[model samples]
Target: MSGRGARGDADESGATSGSLDTVLSFVTGEMAFDPGPYNDAYLDRRVTARIRRTEAETYREYRGLLEADEAEQTALLDALNINVTRFFRNPDVWTVLRDVLAELTANNRTVRCWSAPCADGREPYSLAMLARDDPAIDANRLDIVGTDIDGEALAAARRGEYETTRTTDIAEELAPLSDLDAHVDRDGDSFAVRRPVREMVEFRRHDLLREDPLGEFELVLCRNLLIYIDGDHTRDIFDGLAAAVVPDGYLTIGKSETLPREFRTSFDAVERGAHVYHHC
Candidate 1:
């Protein structure tokens, strides 16, 4: 496994090295949740954190806990899903994406966009807001699909609700490009995306590791999720992503992630700083 867990030898909990494998097998075989796509290290780190939090003295205990507690299963899956995101998280990247969408939708043609692992629907909904606000783009013709492995996250996405405080920050941060005032209806303490904007986006449950890319897209935002994946499945995943983009379409990845060297011929680096590539 991932070499003695996250706590190293200091971890007195019986959930030591290789114990995560036993837990994983139990979750898959008994709990009906498969974590096969995750790297050993990533799984160990995330699962161990959960183990510590649940105060399970041993990996065997954690396995038994998972069997008895449905909530723990959901909690463990949430931990592994790693939903770290915010609306317009990077303004500079959104600025670039705006321009890219402009060119892709030049003739009022329908352009499809995929935000895989779209955490809590913020990214796709942000894209919709941006499209709706930009007069130059035909927002009605834009189609955005957000997919994530977490069903709980997907449920939240469909609800299209967010804390007013977060949306308020986005309104100020994003400025003239887009704002919540124009795209969301405020409730008591939260905001919900307007129907027009929500209509442009759809959410689905998808496992990026085991499933095929959903469809061809003019823009694919597969950011932040690749780092947790190990090398064994990296290239195959990259190959699928490469194949999913329409010719000349764009693929934007996390700042920390890079295209595999072998894909240099298939996708040309178009925005080096933003880690965007154009399918050639």
Candidate 2:
């Protein structure tokens, strides 16, 4: 296809069937997993974004570059996945989480939680903070697992470093509960979560679309991840997430996401505005 046509086609339908087939073949051949679960529009955007970054003249050229360069393949995979996240994002949601966790662990000594697609560890780390602060819950008894498909993001999570700008909003959100400084150590332009908080979370590489549940948990946070996936895959993923939650356990999704119609009867809304639900 002509370069202009390729660009125009991407804008209209993400990619021509032939180019998409080429790209998908290359990715699966190299990465050993299908990118088919993601929405065409989402894939198109990421593919075009990578094309622009590489300054390739056309989709054909871009596919050729991907086939030739292992580094480009990795870069394209990273680009296709969303990794933008922060600590204590949407404070109100955290508040709902805190209340639910408090109630869930009211009679128990241990509480387990999972944060799927926990990019950079901020979300699970935030959960760790709540567990540490709750008087009814013992920090020693709290176990939080953070899983993501991106090794790079997991590495950053392990490093526990963040720039001041990234933590500014988090700091503001935490000011009402406790001093943000107490949970993070500031050094120069970056800050790191305290060792105690970091210790509460364990990071692992996981693909929600293909992998089994990390294990049953009392709470599961799979927020801001479903929007990029197509409908059938989204339902498949939701089924896995629902099964991962213990009976009466809680599941929380992104503010903008909702439970699929098939799942609405199985999970009761605990906090509809916050997208928190109870597995029935």
Candidate 3:
């Protein structure tokens, strides 16, 4: 519920969505967006213009188009989405994950992880590797589920096959930053997750803007995706995520974003520089 929806007087709401405005509107209403680079006018204009090329001329008209055509809507969503991801993209976060797993496994049951907005399929797969390679971590005991709103990304995630050469990039990932590094066998030709590693993850299309958590998790990663969503939606998402994690579970986000002050009380910072948090 970003500032996108109509206010009390303007809206009599149950639930409604599917327009460029719907996304833009939600973000603005829900979050205090960066007016300069990520402004309301900018978001509306960009979405409108992008859809217009396909004959969706106006914001309202685009809404009609989205509502009238499901496939078209999906395409529109794909078009608007920003999925800039890489294997083990954030060195710092990966560092925290490795340490946290080894430390927590010492006392926990099975470790459950949820990767939200798992775009194009790298993050979760990389995580699967972490569990499989770490001796202290019983890969069989780890279950990582990746969720994204886009069906395309979910499909890719399910396939679990990437060009072999892509793996090389991860081998030296964060090399200069050893304290921030997580061992990765960056060999792209061998990039495909082994069947066993793939078995550890479940990928699904979940609209974090809308859905509730299906089960509890020990660790949850909602990264770059939320920066696009407005505060209210982010808030709603975090609330749902919080409830979905065990009382002592961990909640992790991108190194760039931090939980709101209100939520800081709910999860404690487990690793300072790597930006990991655990339920208090």
Per-prediction TM-score to the true structure, in the order listed: 0.85, 0.85, 0.69
How would you encode candidate 3's per-residue C-alpha lDDT over 1-280 as one tens digit per residue? 3544331212344234244445454334433233223334435555655665777544555556655776765564555566767667786688778877776677647888888879877888777777666676666667788998777778887876555344345345424333322333335344445676677788888877667886898888888866666566677878888898788788888877768888888788987766678887
lDDT of 1 by residue, 161-200 (tens): 8774643554454464545578887667667788888888
Residues 69-90 of candidate 2: C-alpha lDDT, one tens digit per residue: 8899888888877798977777
Q: How accurate is candidate 1 locally (lDDT)?
A: 0.80
Number of the candidate with higher TM-score, 1 or 3: 1
Pairs in clash, predicted candidate 2: none
User: What overall lDDT goes with each candidate model?
Assistant: 0.80, 0.81, 0.66
User: Model 1 misses residue 278 by how many Å?
Assistant: 1.3
**Residue 31 CA displacement from its true place in model 3, Å:** 24
